[model samples]
Target: MGNTSVVLRNVSKQFHRKTSGPLTALSDVNLEIAPGEIYALVGPSGCGKSTILNLVAGFDHPTGGSVTVDGQPVSRPGPDRGVVFQEHGLFPWLTAMDNVRFGLDVRKIPDSAEKAQYFLRAVGLAGFEKHYPRELSGGMRQRVALARVLANGPSVILMDEPFGALDAQTRLSMQELLLDVWTEFRPTILFITHDVDEAIFVADRIGVMTTRPGRIMTELRSALPRPRTYHDLASAEFGRLKEQILMSIREVIAAKTE
Candidate 1:
C-alpha cells in the first residue's frame, strides 16, 4: 500500500574465475518491493537468490545495472537496510542483550541497553538476555540476530535463507514469530528461500527464479487470507497453488539438467 521501498533495475552479477571462464550469477533482474509487504525469492541452489539479497543489502555490488532503497541508489551498507543472514552471525563473546545492542553501539546511539532490551523482548528473548550465543539453541540465536536487526529500525529487511538451518518444527515457530514481528513493525521484507511451502507461508507475493543466471520466472500473488495457519496447507486452494509452483520449478530444474 505504501511506496516502493526497494527496486532493482536490470541488475546483473558476475564472478570472475582465475582458472575457469567468467561465471554469471544473475542477469537482467528487475523487481520492485512495496513497503510493508513480504516478498519471497525462491530458487534452486546457486541460482543467485543470495546474490540478489547481497545487492540489496549493499554488501556486494552488481556487475551491471543498479539497486535502490527508498528511491536512492544503494552504494554501501547502511542502517536503513538491515540484513539477517542464514548464519546467526552473533558474537560469541557477547550476551544476547549485548549482541542486540552491538549495532546501536556502533552507531553511537545513546541508551543502547534500553533499545536492546526493547528489541530483545520484541523477539521473545527477554528472559534470556544474559545468556551468551553458545548458551542458546540455533533458533534462539537466530532470534537474537533478528532482534539485533530490528532494534535498528531499518525501513527494509533483507533476509537470505534465515530459517534454512533450523529443523522443521523450529522453522515453523520462527515463521510465526517473524509474522508476528512483521505485523507489529511493518518493515518491507525480502526473504530468500528454497522451500515452496515456506514461501507461501510467509510471503504476500512469491517470485520464482530460474536455475542459474537467475531471473524472475514468475510472480505469484498469495490470495490466501492473512494470519495463515498450517491447516491452510490442507485446503484445496493451497494444494492447487503449491502444485502450480512445483510444476513451474520442476520444469526449470529439468531444463537446467538437460
Candidate 2:
C-alpha cells in the first residue's frame, strides 16, 4: 500500500519583502498524492495555489517543512517531475518537433527525432511538426508544450492552469485531449486551477485551499466515473459536487471578508 507519489509535510512558504516585511503564502499545508492519481487544487486568487506548484516543481523551496516525491526529498528539478504552465512556454525559434525533442536531447535518449514525432502525433500535431510557435495557434502551441512534457516520460506531472488562457470551446477540447493522454500515461498529476468545473472534470480528487496564508480546507472525492465526457458535466452527481465545492468556496470568501 506504499504508493505515495508526492507528499508535502506541514509545508509553509514565506516571502520576505523589503517594505512590507515577511509575507506568508502557504501555511502548514500537508498533502499526499497517490501514484497515478490526478489531484486538483482550487482556491482564492492569491491563496498560494501556484506557490504550491512552484514548490513541488522545485522552482522554489518552502520556508518550513518538507516536499518529497517517492520517499525521496525534492531539492531540485529532476527528470522525474514534469511541469506545464498557463502560457505555452515554447521557443519561437524551434519547430514543434524540435521543442518536443529538446528534453529527449538533454537526456541523451536515442531516436529523439522519432520519439518527438510520436508524441507530437499523440497530441494530434503530426503535420504541424515543422511549424514554429509563431505559426501555430494558441491551442496548437499548448499541444506542443504538452508533447514536450509527455516526451520526457516523467513519473509525476505538475500543471499550473494549463488551459486557463484558452477560449471556452478550445479549453473543453484541450480538456478532452488531456484526459485521453492522461488515461494512456497515468502519471500522478497535481493540477492547480481556479475553475471549479475544470478541477472536477479532470481530477480524481479536488483539494480546496483557504484564503491568504493558504492551507487545504477540505478535499472532495469525485464520484464521477472515468472516461468522462462533456455530457457528464450535466449529470446530477456533477451538479451535487459543484454545489458542494461552491459552498465551501463561499464560506472561505465570507471568512476572508469578515
Candidate 3:
C-alpha cells in the first residue's frame, strides 16, 4: 500500500454511562501524521491515547470534529487502515502463517500464502510458520502479530501499546524490529505508548498529552537519527528528549492530582 496522510481535526469524544453522567475522553484533540512518518503519542493513562487511535482506526466515532485519511473522512474500518493492540490478538487455533493469512483470505486477496510467508520472514519468523500462538513465546507471538498486520499491506498502521507487555530486553528487540519493518514497508504509523524512552526511540515525532480532558500538550521531532539502534538510546539527544517528555508527563499528573 502507498503511504497516506492522517488528520484529526478538533476531535473530541465523550462517553456517557447511566450512573456516571458523561466522561470526556478527549477534548479538541487535533493531530496530523504525515505520510510514511512514525508518530508516537505519549501520555498518562486515561489521557485518551488509545481513544485517539480508536477514532482514527474507525473503531469509534468522535463526538465532534473529523478524522480523515488521504483527505477522505473515515466513516468505518477499512482495509487501508490496520490496527495492532498490545495483545497479540491472534487466534490460538491458527498457525503463525494462518493468522497472517486470515485477513488476506477474508478480503479475498490472492497469493495469500506467499505474502504471509514473506512477512513472517521479514519479522524474523521464517520457520515458525506452523506454530500456534500457544506454542510460541511472548516475543515470537508478537512477531507473528506484527507480520499479520504487515501482510495486509495497509497504508496506515495504528498501534496501541504494542510493546508494553514484553520484558525490557524483548521490548528493545521488538523496537528495533519495528523500525526495520517500517524502513522496508514505509507505512504511516500512529504508535501509542506510555514509555518515554520507547516513544523517543521509535517515533519520528512524539506527541505528549495533557491530563483528563486529553489533548496534545507538545510535540517533539526526534533527531537521534534512524534505522535506530540500541546505541542511540545512550545518545545525549535521546536523553534530552526523554527528560522533556517525562517532565511534561509529570506536570500533567501533578495537575491531575492537584
On TM-score, the leading prediction is 2
Per-model clash counts, in order, read 0, 0, 0
TM-score of each: 0.97, 0.98, 0.97
* TM-score result, candidate 1: 0.97
Angstrom error of the Cα, residue 240, model 1: value is 2.1
Q: Tell me which of candidates 1 and 2 scores higher on lDDT.
A: 2
User: Per-residue CA lDDT of candidate 1, range 182-256, in tens?
Assistant: 999999999999899999889999998998899999899888887888888888868877888899899889999
TM value for model 3: 0.97
Q: Name the 10 consecutive residues with the lowest summed lDDT in model 2.
A: 1-10
lDDT of each: 0.92, 0.94, 0.92
**Residue pairs with backbone overlap in model 3:** none
